[model samples]
Target: MRIGITSPVVTAVPGVHSPWERGAGIEELGAVAEAADRLGFHHLTCSEHVAVPADVAEQRGGTYWDPLATFGYLAARTRHIRFATQVLVLGYHHPLAVAKRYGTLDRISGGRLVLGLGVGSLEEEFQLLGAAFEGRGAVADDALAALRASLSRREPAHHGEHFDYAGFVVEPHAVQERVPLWIGGRTPRSLRRAVAHGDGWVPFGLPLDRLREMVGAASLPEGFEVVLSAGRPLDPSGDSDGTAKALRGVSEAGATLVSVSLAAESAGHYLEQLEALTRIADAVAAEEGAA
Candidate 1:
């Protein structure tokens, strides 16, 4: 039962954004990455959005850092921690382009990259990017196949409904023989995609029972990951025992990797919360080991 963190202070959401995050800069982001690495977190994830429409900016909050660039920056700052895109919208970019960007990221990060891909929900953003908003599921399915082909070989080729390319080598091929591809979402179609194509399932906000049901339905291969969001702050008020219980429940519920998010007022507060969460995770792991 490994633990990962959704990178804090990078995406600003109303009610979720800490006051200090508004003033935070790149250095602060580096500090958080470094802290997650030092604290033994399995992975640090960043969200992505090429652009947010003005009408939805109020609800979505318009401050999304480019995941590829952000991860590149963090790669230099962290050693052991894996970097992930919490969910990169597959319909927004060409498959080969994504393959190249993330493949290079994996190469530079020493094979520590988890590609969490999704068919995005924002219709307006899709319109802005000129990516077909409707039939995005089909688009994502094709894109996933194309990405698989492209990332696995130096001279890759793919012929799909949306993309076609061949005989072009993607240099500096991914460090991992097969980069772990995680599909994200809670929809039935999403679950099917995970079972059919993904190396892992990355589901957010699903209840424990629902998570177990979904995992049972999927015919995951051996070592296939089920990464679930913890769905709440581990220590909302510094309750380590409570945090441990919550995490243990998640592990028992069949989450191979649990992603924990913390709400903090400052970098210092975020680091403190991370340390507390790490202790709770370690305790849970120790008990599991003993059992």
Candidate 2:
């Protein structure tokens, strides 16, 4: 399995975020990214939320680094590690805007971008952004279709029920002939959408057993990725056996890409965990090779 991080301090979700993250900024973030990049980690994520409702801020993470800015900075700092937007709410931006802004990012990063998109559920935030709240799933489907046609093309055109465009040139478009798209959600419909419209599925908040059954039953295409996370933070430095076992379980549950959060109280501790995890992964690979 390819290992990645749901990067620290990028999105401070309640109960999940560490206390030290409240004070951490880009310098600390850069160090962690640089270490992961050097360690051969596959990807790192930043989530997107334009704004959260005051009442729901504590429930949904109030802190989100806009993916574009965060990834643009981190991309320059890291060479091999890919940048994944854990999700960008599909209804919030037009397909062309995503194509242009993220396309520039792809060009800048040397084609190291993965677009993870979702049909968002925050009704208040949707209204706040003046996005159409109803029938968003259909809108997202159309948007995905448009994105597929336009992501790498300079002069792209698409005609669909909800979105249509032609005669527009997107300069410095995505360098990859096909940029990876990962759909996000925890439901069956989300899985279907990923199969129908995306390259991978990034499912959150599902139990491991449920995840196993869902992925096992789906008619996934060849090389379709199931990117999954552990139920809780892992302590690779302090608890290598447990961390390794948890990572193994994630793979057994059918994750082609495994996203991990570390048990750390501070910036230094988090970097320690990254190195520890890499050592453990190397050890496991060595043993498997010997077998």
Candidate 3:
């Protein structure tokens, strides 16, 4: 069972670590990354959001360090831990530019990049970025196809509805001929997208029962992985077993990766919460060994 922590974004904070709080600067973010590396976290992931909605606006801070730049900083600071974006809002980025960036990060991190993607839900953000809001899903599909083609060959070519080019190749190709691509979202359409194109599924808003149902219906390829991380309520008293139960449920539902999220008030507070989760990971590891 591999265990990892969500990045120290303000969304992970309970209250006091709002984007306005300035609680964790770049330096502290680096410290948090180093701590995860030392603590045996398998992968460190960050969410991408240009703006926050009213539904989440007050609960989570409205701003975040761009995930790619932050991961580049982390890649320089850590050695073994993998770097990933929980979901990078694929439609918002040009495929060629994104391909180049991830390719560079993959090389620098020795091929430890996992590019999770989504078609984002915020129309306001789309308007802000000057992207066609209504066409995002179709554009995202095209982008994914282009990305797949661009990353497969030594010198790749692509001509798509949203993006077009020929005789184009990204230098510093990913360590893996094709880097891992995980798709996230909980709707049936999203699940279908995952089964059709994604290497993994990360549904973040479904209940355990529903998650199992979706897993059964998804009909994802054999060996295709699932990562369970719904930003829902967590039992505070579960101690170490709280995470274990979640992970066990995910495993039974066919998930191969389990991630735990910590909610706190600041970087220090979040680190304190991580200690509690680490204790759980240690206990889980012990139980597996004993069994």
Candidate 4:
């Protein structure tokens, strides 16, 4: 099993809203990325959001660096670890622009890019980007189609309900023939989209059984990925080795990767959580090696 960590978005603010508000600064993010790389993690994911929702805006320090730029920053600092967008909201970006940006990042990072794509529910973000919030689904579908077509050929053409283009070869061709695209969302439609266009499914907020069922029902291509969130504290009843034990079950369930999020309290807390993750990763790696 591969292990990864989520990068904390940095911003200036106090306890204002959800944990999303308390993103860390760029310096902190760089340090964490370096740390993860040295400690044997295989991937690092960054979240994207234009603004925090009104209700949680203050409590959550709502600033976010453009994911592509942030990944560039990370690429300069780390080696070997793949970079990912935890979920880049499809509606907020032009598909062609995203394809170009991602392709460049993949080249800059030497083929280490994972595109985790999602639809944003934040209407404020849509209004800000001049996108129709109601059409996000259609937009995402079209974007996925465009990305696939454009990335495959020297010159590609696309004509879809929401996006249409002709005669463009996204240069700096993705270091890989295709950057691995993982669909991110927890809806039936999302599963179908993953089956049709995605190389993997990255689901959040679902229990183990539900995740298994979704994977079983989804018409995935052979070698498709299933990555589960592993940030929240597992029940403490399993003893000192419980974390490793739980990770083993997840790995046995065919999770190609597992990402653990720290309960952000302070730098110390975050680092402590990362240390715990290192131990778990070591255990999991050993199990996989033995297998």
Candidate 5:
């Protein structure tokens, strides 16, 4: 299975993020991006949250780096590693807007963009954005359809239940003929949505057994990627065997791509873990090659 960095410093979750991330800025983030690009990590992810509620911020990780700005900078710095949104809340923006903006980004990045989208769960955020909270899932479904019809086309057009547009010209549309779309959620319905409207499913907050059951039950199409997490942050620098086992276990759990999280205490320490994990990944690949 291909491995991608879960990406640090971009979102400083209270318990999961390193303490050093609180003070780090784009410089540090860029450094990590450059290193990740050079080290052969398949992709680097950044999630979106315009504003998190103060009450939920503590638990949900208040500091969400804007994926567009972050990816734009990282794109300029990196050569090949893809930029994934981990998820951009679909209810927050118009499909054509997404197509236009990310299409420009795809053009700039030479088509190294993996669009991750979600229907969004926070009702308050939906209200804050003046977006429809009721029947949002259905709207999101339509939006996904519109997006599918729109992305990568200059004169894109679509007619859906909630959204209908035509004759709009989007210059510098996505470079890739078909940009990869990954739906994000942690439920069976989310899996179905991904199957119907996206290229992959990225579920979070589920145990390995639950994930395995859901994946086994689903009718995933050919080339439909299931991206499972590498579980807890891996301490490959301290426990190489444990790290290797966790990585392999994620692959065995039916993941076509694994989101590898590294445990570290500081920025420097994080880079060390990144390097260590890369070495472990390389060794794993070599071992598989020899076998």
Candidate 6:
């Protein structure tokens, strides 16, 4: 199983943010990215939100970094680790714009980009951005199709309900022939969308039994990834064995990739937790190989 991390300190959720993160800036973010890279984590993910409504800011902890800018910055610093937008709201921007931004990011990052996308849940945010909120699922489906076309070819073309363009060249095509598009969300419509359009599925807050059922129902192609969030804090010192066991369970439940979040108070603490999790991942791989 591949292990990835939703970068700490990047999106400061009330409980997830470390004490040191209040004063932390790009330097601290770089340290965390470097540590994950050095420790052999598969990918480092960032979240996105253009603007948060005042009512939701408290719950959402409104400090989201632009994924393109953040990943572009980290791409220069890390060599092996991939950069992912944990879930970019596809409805918020034009498909060509996303293609231009993230496709270039993939080229600059040496093809290490995974475009994790979603229809987005925030009605108010969509309203603020002047994006239609009612039929977002349809919008996202069309957007994904347009993005696929735009990223795969130098002279890209697409004709759809939401977007239409042809006979125009989109230069600096993505390094990968097809940048992986992972759909995010756990709704039935989301799962259907994943099976139909996604190269991977990223489901949040899903229980093990439901995950198993969903994975079984979907007709995933060979090597199609089921990426799951660990959903709880990972504490290396308190329960290393328990962490391994939980991850092993996730692996067994049909997840090809697991993104873990660690509870840490400082950069040093974060690195230590990453090292411990790396050990756990290595052990899991070894055991799986033997099995």
Best by lDDT: 2
- Model 1 TM-score, 2 decimals: 0.94
Q: TM-score, each model?
A: 0.94, 0.97, 0.86, 0.84, 0.97, 0.96
lDDT of 2 by residue, 1-291 (tens): 479998999988887888999999999999999999999999999998998988889787799998999999999899999999989999999999999999999999999999999999999889999999999999999999999999999999999999999999999899999999999999999999999999999999999999999999999999898999976888898999998788878878998888998879899999999999998877766765677
Of 2 and 4, the candidate ahead on lDDT is 2
Model 3 ranges off by over 4 Å:
10-22, 52-56, 152-154, 230-238, 264-276, 285-291
Best by TM-score: 2
lDDT of 3: 0.74
Q: What TM-score number comes out for model 5?
A: 0.97
Clashes of each: 0, 0, 0, 9, 0, 0
Q: Can you write out model 5's per-residue Cα lDDT over 1-291, one digit (the tens) per residue?
A: 478998888997777787778898999888888988998888999998888999899799788888998999999999999999899989999999999999999999999999999989999999999999999899999999999999999999999889999998999899899999999999899999999999999999998888888999899999999998988888989999999988877766789998987888888888898899988887877876787
**Which residue runs of candidate 4 sit more than 4 Å off their true CA positions?**
10-24, 58-61, 152-154, 233-242, 252-254, 263-276, 285-291
Clashes of 6: 0
Model 5 regions more than 4 Å off:
286-291
Summing lDDT over every window of 10 consecutive residues in candidate 3, give the lowest-scoring window.
230-239
- The better candidate by TM-score, 1 or 2, is 2
List the lowest-lDDT window of 10 residues for candidate 1: 231-240
Q: lDDT per residue, candidate 4, 137-196, as tens digits?
A: 988988988778776345668898888889767776676787788989888788788878
Winner of 3 and 4 under TM-score: 3
Candidate 6 Cα errors over 4 Å, as ranges: none
Candidate 1: list runs displaced more than 4 Å: none
lDDT of 6 by residue, 33-106 (tens): 99899988989998889999877989988989989999999999999899889899999989878877888999
Local distance difference test scores for all models: 0.85, 0.92, 0.74, 0.74, 0.90, 0.87
